[model samples]
Structure formats: structure tokens, C-alpha cells
Target chain A: MTLTDESPPMVNQAPSVPATQTVTLTVNGTAVELQLAPWTSLLDALREYMQLTGTKKGCDHGQCGACTVLVNGKRINSCLTLAIMQEGNSITTIEGLAQPEGLLPIQQAFIDHDAFQCGYCTPGQICSAVGLMNEGHAKTTDDIRELMSGNICRCGAYTNIVDAIQAVMHPQPDKL
Target chain B: MINFDYTRADGVTSAVRDRASELTAKFIAGGTNLIDLMKENVERPTRLIDINRLPLATITETEGGGLRLGALMTNADTAYDKQVSKRYPLLSQAILAGASAQLRNMATDGGNLMQRTRCYYFYDVATPCNKREPGSGCSAINGFNRIHAILGTEAGTPDRSIHCIATHPSDMCVALAALEAVVRVTGPDGDRTIPFAEFHRLPGNTPHIDNTLKDDELITAIDLPANGFSKNYAYLKLRDRTSYAFALVSVAAALEMEDGRITDARIALGG
Candidate 1:
């Protein structure tokens, strides 16, 4: 048998469909419009189209939380949602988390607690933590650990990550 | 993923009409599952009707003292809803037991019911999967069948020959079945309600057909009866990991007790 890159015959390929459509998204605080293909994921639209590469794509599928972003203040897997579907929603990526004056409290906490080794999963972890705080569900260390379990740290920086989030959730004056 | 035409449906009637008019059109709401399937080439809809704009994102109370969860309501919202957590704690617990927070935020209640199996072979296009392709034969039957269904197999039911062993992979649906929730749907034929137990089907001769939903039918809402078993209920999930993992075996159990004795019991399993 010869090697080929073709898909199976059962897969239906729509060739005559319109290639791309324009969608307006409110990222961080600014609204921008971009023309994108229907198959383009929100992750790709941010990384490739809008030139915002802060949101990492660890797994294009929803398995990895590396592409996690806040949509209207709720964290969602950007890889799972289509870019066109997210139109009119307010999206916040890691790049958008920091303010012009200084870094967000979570970012400073991550740095203070040494929450990262390779730093690939930090963005997602921090964004997920922000989303967790927004939801106001985590009340304890265990709650922080459970709520932030979506972002995986292959470097095994889980302990520091949890500490960083817990510190933010329940801040001690001395620690601060 | 294959390129497809995208159109936003302004209303439920137009959405149904568009879906019914086209054979390969699909409705997209919280595209957590459908997009995953599409990327894997397991699904190829020529046209996608974005149903996120539809007015099916509310949770209302029914006349029977039950709750009606709109189809577009996100799983996270549904689980965290005050009414659901108070009255339907079983459903809330089950929803929380599955998936990560990010996924729960994107997955809809209707999409959760429409979730496909997590069978390894079903996702591998290189392998022959009866669920992915009709009459293609099941690879999980004899190959690494650890996560396959333990009940409702061909060996267990002689009358209904099972062609596949894949199990429904939703933790929320397991609780819904135990609670006897009703699924309200709208189609070209009009509106109807499907009993939760009858919504999902066992993999029989045709494993490709996952649910009893007809073509062009759209799930409008899921109604939970007044009896939510909030006082006595449990959702247990065993998997490779505690979070962000598919369940190897899960159980949603509810009970009605009288004088510390079980009067009525309902249990549903998922994998």
C-alpha cells in the first residue's frame, strides 16, 4: 500500500462552501474585526489572526486547558468554540490580564510563589484562577486546587500553582 | 476541519426549517463536543446554524413545580444555578463530577445529552468503528475493551443483537435518567417531549444512531420533575484521574426514604 495524506472516503468535504466570514470580537477591552474561516477556532483566531499569541495551544482539542480564556468573564476552552461563535462576547486572554499600571494580582502571586517551571501552562493557570475568583466558589485551599484542575502543568508545578491561587483567594497580611 | 457555510439562526422556527431543509446542516450551541468531533472528521456538516443567539438560554419554572433548563444554557451555569443546586442537587453534583471548569463553561445541557462515546476506536478514523461508520465493525469489541460497556451487550440481550459496546459518556445524563427528567424538543413535526430513559438508546444492530432524536429535531429544553432527590442522592465517578478525565465507570443513585428505609430508588450508570 502507498502512503497518502488523504482522509477516508467516509469524510465529507464541502468544497463549494464560502471560505471565510468576518466576525467582531471584544478582546481585553478593545473591539476588533477579522475575516476568518468557519473552521477557525477562537484559539486560532487569537493566535494566528489577531496576532495575540499569549494564549498557548498545548492541545488543539479541549483536553488541555492551555487555550483557556475568559469569555464574558467565564473561562472556556477556546479550542472548542468557533471564532465566529464568539462574536460580540468579551474575551480576555493572558495578554489582557495585566493592566497598564502593573501586573494583575494573580500574576504577581504566580511570580512571588514561583508557580511555573517551563512557563507554558502559566497563562492558562492564571486565567483559570482569575475565572475561579470571578465565580467566587473557591473558599479553601482544597477548593482552589479542585477548581483550577483544568490547567495541567507537565513540569509538575502544581504545588506552587495551588499555593499562588490560594494566596490570592485567602491572602495573609504577612504574606502579602 | 472541513470548511462549511455558517449562518446564525434568528429564531427556533428558522433554525428547524434550515436544518430540515438541508440534510447535512447542524446546529451549533456551545460547540464543545461537536467541534471536537468535527476536528476528528467523525462529523462533517455542510452547513452550521449558529444557535447561540436563540432565546433558549434561560431556566424557568414549570407549572408542576419542576425546572426547565434551556438548551443553550451552559453546563457550568446550569450546575451553578441556585434553583438547580437547591432542588436538583443530584444533577448539580453529577455535572460537577464531570469535565473541567473550562469545558463545563462551554458545554451546554443539550450538547451534554448529545455527547458521543469516548471509545478510543470511535475517535480513531484509521480504525473501523461501527459507531462512527455504520457496518464498519467494532474494534473495541475485542481490542482493549476495558472501558467498554459492561451491560446491554449482545451477549446479555439475545433479542437485541448489539453491534457495539460503546457507552454514553455524559455524567449529567446519567443523573437526568435517574431523576426521570423530560427532554423537550422542536422539529418540523412540531414539539414533543422524550422521557430521559428513552432518549438514549443501547447500542443495538445500528450503533451509529446514538439517540431517538429524529432528523431536523432540536432539543429545546430539559425539564426536571419536582422530585430531584435532593435529600438523598449520590454521584460517584471512577476514572484514571479525578478531574478532566473520562469516567471508567460512574453511577448516579437517588433514593426516597421512609423511616430510614428505602421506599423508592433510581440508579443510572455511565462510562
Candidate 2:
């Protein structure tokens, strides 16, 4: 279960030289092109190259979900994936979570439910929640908690986060 | 990070040839681990051959009523695949039990098998880790070893002293070992197959060498035998937390029972 990325990066004293790659991504509804180093992760590409800092970089090692983004309709750790590797993939960050007209239901739900505090991890949590709802895996509150374990909120807003997600999962929960 | 050349592989044959022929050339599939290592200055690859466009991401059936998992198949897709869920449920359960949804979506099957140990000393360059540096003394030996491996261990001289007891940190590979899968590879010498159980070598005198994959070899696919451990299979993951954490120790067990008696069983442990 050692739930690390495919490979845990070991320490090294090897010599390294910078190399760059051009990537074309349809981000949030817009197509963005950037030239970045092969080692530049998707998190960095979005945050630095594209100037979309909504995606936070918590661990930069895939341990934290603060850099979560939707790539082709599925959530993934942006920090663990290289920018060049994601070329041609449509990426959706927290800033793009809303519609052209207004905020997304999940975004509004977070505010309505007060699902965050300090709000540093809010972007990742919101993006992850959108992906979680689309995957349609979480059925119960506990299931939501387990499935959303990747996104950590230091504010201890677990109950409210679950409530917000549950409201979207089963809208009738409020009516009941 | 060191400057390197990047080439998108046109096909499987060319990908293997390019990687095998060139030194310090690695096939970048998901980039989940490769990029991470690059940032830590661990793996200094001079050329990153992109193989994501290759047609090696499919999950199909083999001719012998078995399943063929493509090397580029992401962990999430394989875990949620209808066939994997029905046939090799142990693998599905094991994968789901490991990384989170975001990581699973990006981690590929080939990368999963190629995972390195999570030993703290191995990841901290300031420390002396024989795995990272062959001659570097192992700090974990005298340091904290709560997560050290308890199974298969050996000691060697300081120059090659491989007394590193770091355990494999892959839940998927643990299931693969128990299920007896075959790793298909294409190398400079052409194609070859390796038994799953023998994929990961025990931490012997060479703790640095994680698996049997050669420098130039490229993993093409993983062939899983016909549904053998479907029912009565359980993936038990134990760690500091209930989820989003590596297993301190985990078990993948598939049992076959007749009436009230046990007929056959396969179990593998992971940490």
C-alpha cells in the first residue's frame, strides 16, 4: 500500500542538464502552448508557464493532492506527471472548474457547506471532488471520506467536506 | 535537472530500439515516477523517449484465454476495468488500496512494477544510503528502521555491502507476484518474457538494482493467466491511516475452498 507514485524518487548526486519540450494543452476551454523543461511537472506548467496558480503545490512529490487537476475528465496528480507527457491532453484546473456563466456546483457547494478553512487546499479539494463525483464511486459519507483521502485539509473540515460532496452525490439528502 | 533530449516514440519497435541503443535513454510513459526522480536529481536521464502515443495502452485478452495488460495502461484504468474487476480482482483491489485516485489515474502498470523502495535514507541525499550510492554506508542500519524489510536480506562488504533491508513499496506488484503474471519485454536482443515472481529481485548485495529489467530493456506488456484467483480474494492494507498511505504491511490472498476444506491458496506480502 505504500501509496507513493509509481516510483519513489531517491536521492542522488548525479549530474543533470536542463532539456525543454513544447506542449499543447486545451486548458479549461482554452488552448495553451508552452515550452518547458522535460522535468517541469504539470503542476509547474500550469502554475508557472500558464500563470494559473490556482493549482497549489503542496508536496511536489505526489504525496499531497494540492496539485490535482482533471486531465481528460479524470483527476490526476499534476506534480507527478511531466508537462511534456501531458501534451495534447485537455487539462482542467480549479480556476477552470466553473462554467462560462457562473461557478460550478461543486465550487458553490464548498462555499455553501463551508468545506474549507484557510483555503490553501481548497483548490485541490474542489477539483478532486469534481472528479470524484464524475467517477461516481462514493455512495455513502464514509465512502466519500475514504475516496477523498487524497486531499488533505488541515482545518479539520472533514464533516463539512463530506456534507458538500454528499449534497452533490444525492441532492435529495437536503430534502430529506 | 540535467538537460536531455526528448523524442516521442513512433512505435514499440522503434521505442525499444532507441532506448536499447542509446545510453541514459529512458521510455517515459506516465512520467509519474520518472519526473519525480528527475526533480530529486536521482535519475539523470539524458534522453526521455516519450511512449505515450504508442498503441501500448490497451487491456486486451491473450490467445491463451489470458489477459494482456499493456505497459502504458494507467493504474486507474486497469483497476476499474470490467475484466480486471471480474477476473483478477486481487489486482484491482490491490491497486485501489494503494495510491489515491489522482495518482492511480497517472501511474502506469509498467511504472508500478518498476517502483523503487521508499526508505527514508534512500530518498535523502544528505544521508549515506548504499542503495542510492553504492559505497555510501547505510544509515538505516543504525538509524530508525521501523519500515525496514523483515524478509530476504543479505550483507556484503562496504564497497558492495548490500545489507540494505528496504522493502518493495508496490501493492500491485505484490498481487502480480501472487497471481503469477509474466512480464513481456523488448530489448536489444529482441523479445523475452520474465516470470512475475522473479521480476523484483530480493535486496541482495546490490540493493540498488530493484528489478531484473536490463538497462536497455523496455517493458511491453504484462500477461496475466486466466482467471485463477477471482473469488475468495482479499487485499488487506495496513498503514498509519485508512487510505492515501503506503502499507506498513499488506497482504494479497486468494483462496480456493471445497465444501468446508481449503483446496488452494496464494498469498503475498507488501510493505
Q: Which candidate is the best by lDDT?
A: 1
TM-score of each: 0.95, 0.92
Candidate 2, residues B1-271: lDDT per residue as tens digits?
A: 6667788898888888888677567788777777777777667777899888888899989998999999999998999899998999999989999878888888899988987788888877788886777656788878887787655443433332345778888899989988889999988888999999888876556667788888788898999988658878998988988998888889989888889788988989889
Per-residue lDDT tens digits of candidate 1, residues B197-263? 9999766666777899987999999999988899999999998887777888999999999999999
> Chain B, model 2, TM-score against the native?
0.94
Candidate 1 matches the true fold with a TM-score of 0.95
Write one digit per residue (lDDT tens) for candidate 1, span A40-157. 8999999999989999999888776999999999999899998989888999999998889999888999999999999998899989988998888888877777788888899998
Interface Cα RMSD in Å, per prediction:
7.2, 8.6
Clashing pairs in 2: A1-B246, A1-B247, A2-B246, A2-B247, A3-B246, A16-B2, A17-B2, A17-B3, A18-B2, A18-B3
Give me the runs in candidate 2 sitting further than 4 Å from their true place.
A1-21, A172-176, B153-162
CA lDDT of every candidate: 0.87, 0.82
